[model samples]
Target: MIVAAVDAQNLVDALGLGSIYALMAVGIGLVFGVLRLINFAYGQLIMAGAFTLAYASRANWSTWESIVACFAVVIGLSLVMDLAVFRPLRTQSPATMLVATFAVSFLLQSIALLTVLKVQGQLGMPASTVARLSQAVTIWGVDVRKVTIVSIVAALVALGALALLLGKTTVGLQMRAAATDFTTARLLGISANRVIGFAVLLSGLIAAVVAVLLTARTPYVQSDFALHDMIYVLVGVVVGGIDRLWTATLGGFAIGFASGVIYGALPTDKTAYLPSVLFALVIVVLLVRPAGLFAPRGTSTVERV
Candidate 1:
C-alpha cells in the first residue's frame, strides 16, 4: 500500500513534468521542422518571459496583466531575433547559423543576469506570483498540486490549438511544405520569410506559456532558470527522433516522466546523480538506435532547428 501510494504520487508529478517538457519539445521541433535550425537560444525566450512576469509582479500587476506582459515580451523578442540575426543568415551554412544562435544564447543570458543584478541585486520574483501555483488539491484521497493540473491542461489545449493551426490554416500548410523541403517550398511559391516568421511566432508563444507555468512552479526566476530544462528537452528531441514532430513530443514526455520517476525513487541524498543517470541512458539509447529510439527503421530524411 505504501509503495502504491508513492507510485501514484510520482505518476502525477511525471504527468505534469511530461506536459511541460512536451510543450518545449513542440516549440523546439516547430522551429527545427521549418527552419532547420537548432535554436540554442530558445530557452532565453522563456527566460525573458519569466523575468517579465517577475517585473510585472513587482509592479503589483494583476495575473492577467502579468501574463499579457510575459507573452508580449517573449513574442517581441522572438520576432526581433528572427529579423535581426536569423533572417539575415538564412542562406548561410548550417554551421554558421548554429554558431550564431550559440552566441545569441550567451548574449541574452549575460544581459539577463546583469540586468537582474543591477535592479534587484539578485535573482528574485515576487512570492505571491508563484505561491498559489504550488497549492495542493485533493483527488480520490490523494493530494496533487494545482499547478500540475494546470500544466497538463495547458499543454493539451496549446497542442490542440497548434494542431488546428498547422492542419487547417493556410500558413500552417506552407510551414508543412517548408518543413518537408524548403527549396521545394520556395519553388512552390511559398514565401520563405513568412513561413519562417510564423514558426518563430508559434515557438515564442509556446515559450511564453512554459515561462508562466515554470515560474509558478519554481518561482525563483533565476538567470539560468530554463537552461537545464532546455538541455533536457533538446536531448529528448534527439532521442525521440528529431525528424518527426510526434516523435520529438514523445521523446520530451518520456524524458520528463523518467526524470520524475527517478527523482521520486531516489534517496534524497543521492538525487544529485539524476542528470548523470539520465544522460548515461541517453548515450546507451543513442549507441543502440543511432537514429533515435522512436524513429522508424530505414528512415533517412534530411531534417533540422
Candidate 2:
C-alpha cells in the first residue's frame, strides 16, 4: 500500500513536470516543423516573457495587463525575426540558414542574460514567487499546486487552439501545404510568406503560454537553467518525436515520471545527475529514431488558434 501510494504521488508530480515540458516542446516543435531550425534561443523567449511580466508588475501594472503586454512584445519580436533573420536566411543554403538561426538564438540569449543581470544583481529565482508557491492542495495523496493545474490547463487549451488553427482554418490549410512542400505551397498561391509569419507568431504565442505557466508554477523565474531542465525538455521531444505533438506530450509525462522516480531514489548530493540521464536518453533516442517515436506513424499535429 505504501509503494502504491508513492507511485501515485510520483505520477502526479510527473504529470505536472510533463505538462511544463510539453508547453516548451510545442512551440519548439512548431517552429522546427515549419522552419526546420532548432532554435537554442527558445529559453530566452521564456525568460523574456517572465522578465516582461516582472517588469510590468514592478511598474504597477496588473498581472493580466502584464500578460497582454508580454504577448504584444513577443509577437513584435517574432515579426522582427521573420522580417530580418528568417527572410535573409531563406535565400541561403540550409546549412547557412541553420547557422543563422543558431547565431540569432545566441544573440537573444546574450541580450536576455545581460538584461536580467542589470535588473537583478544575482540570477537564481526571483525573490517574489517563493512565498506565492506555499499554498497547495493534496489530491490522490499528491501535494499539487494550483499553478501546476493552471499550467496543464493552459497547455491543453493552447494545443486545442493550435489544432483548430491548423485543421479548420484556411490559413492552417495553407500552412499544411507549405510544411510538406514549401515550393508547391508557394506555386499554389498559398502566400507562403504569410504562412511562415503566422508560424512564427504561433511560436511566440506558445512561448508566452509556456512562460506564464512555468513562472506560475516555479513561483518565480530563474535566469540560469542548469542544463538539466534544458536536457529534460529536449529528451521529451526527441523521444516522443517532435513530429507527433501528442507523442511529445506523452513523452513529457514519461520523462516527468522518470525524473520523479530518479530524484526520489537518489541521494540529495547526486541529484544533478538526473538531467544528464535525460540528456543521455535524448541522445540514445536520437540515435535510434531521429524522426521521433510518433513520426513513423505519420501523425500530424492540429492545434487551435
- Candidate whose TM-score is highest: 1
Tens-digit lDDT string for candidate 2 (1-305): 32443565566666666777777777767766666665566776767777676767667776678778778877677778778988878767667777776687667766767776787765533523223443578987778877667767877887798789889999888877776667877888888678888888888887777666666656455554323454577667767866555666666656766786666556678877867766776778767666665556544433310
The residue ranges of model 1 lying beyond 4 angstroms of the native Cα positions read 1-6, 301-305
Per-residue lDDT of 115-134 in model 1, one digit per residue for the tens?
98999987655535656788
Error of 1 at 46 (Å): 0.5
TM-scores of all predicted structures: 0.95, 0.84
CA-RMSD of model 2: 4.4
The best candidate in terms of lDDT? 1
lDDT of 2 at 34: 64
Model 2 spans with C-alpha error above 4 angstroms: 1-6, 124-134, 220-222, 225-230, 244-253, 283-290, 297-305
